[model samples]
Target: EPEVTQTPSHQVTQMGQEVILRCVPISNHLYFYWYRQILGQKVEFLVSFYNNEISEKSEIFDDQFSVERPDGSNFTLKIRSTKLEDSAMYFCASSGLRSTGELFFGEGSRLTVL
Candidate 1:
């Protein structure tokens, strides 16, 4: 079975630094998303991309955050400036349909902001 893969399972960065988390979602999936979990907090949606454009995004995806599908097989999330509160486990997900309620997720890239 195909699955999402993320690079750098763990990352530690200082405050105000830039961070880029990478992911390769299943090839056949059409929609992709970035979600984050702040330690013990609930999972929060950051952004979604489809057809090479941003489909939707949450308020947490502020000016500092950006998503891109730079090629045929990769999806990426970039945080221009990291903050202490930005430390979290970022998950990359893909699905065939938004209403299907089923998303395939990666193991997650952990980001630690000092």
Candidate 2:
């Protein structure tokens, strides 16, 4: 089955540095989302995008975080500045439709800030 794939499965960066987490969601899915798990915490929603526009975003997705579908198949999340608190396993997900609430998540990109 098709699935989401993320690059740089694990990344270590210094505080104040910038990081870009990339993902290619399922080709047929219509909705994409970025979620994060801070170490042992439960998954938290960061933002949702559809049709090249942001549909909704969480408070956690503040000025520092941005999302884009730069091309047809690739979706991306960019952190303007890395912070210790930003360390987490970021997941890229997609669903065939929004009402289903069923998301297929990627392996996740682990970000570790020093």
Regions more than 4 Å wrong, model 1: 97-99
Candidate 2 residues lying further than 4 Å off, grouped into runs, are none
lDDT tens digits, residue span 1-114, model 1: 899999889999999999999999999899999999999999999999999999999999999999999988999999999999999999999998556989999999999999
Question: Can you give the TM-score per candidate against the true fold?
Answer: 0.96, 0.96
* Candidate 2 lDDT tens digits, 1-114: 798999889999999999999999999998999999998899999999998899999999999999988889999999999899999999999999657878999999999999
The most accurate candidate by lDDT is 1
Residue 28 displacement in candidate 2 (angstroms)? 0.9
For model 2 the local lDDT of residue 105 reads 96
The lDDT values for all models are: 0.96, 0.95
The number of clashing residue pairs in each candidate reads 0, 0
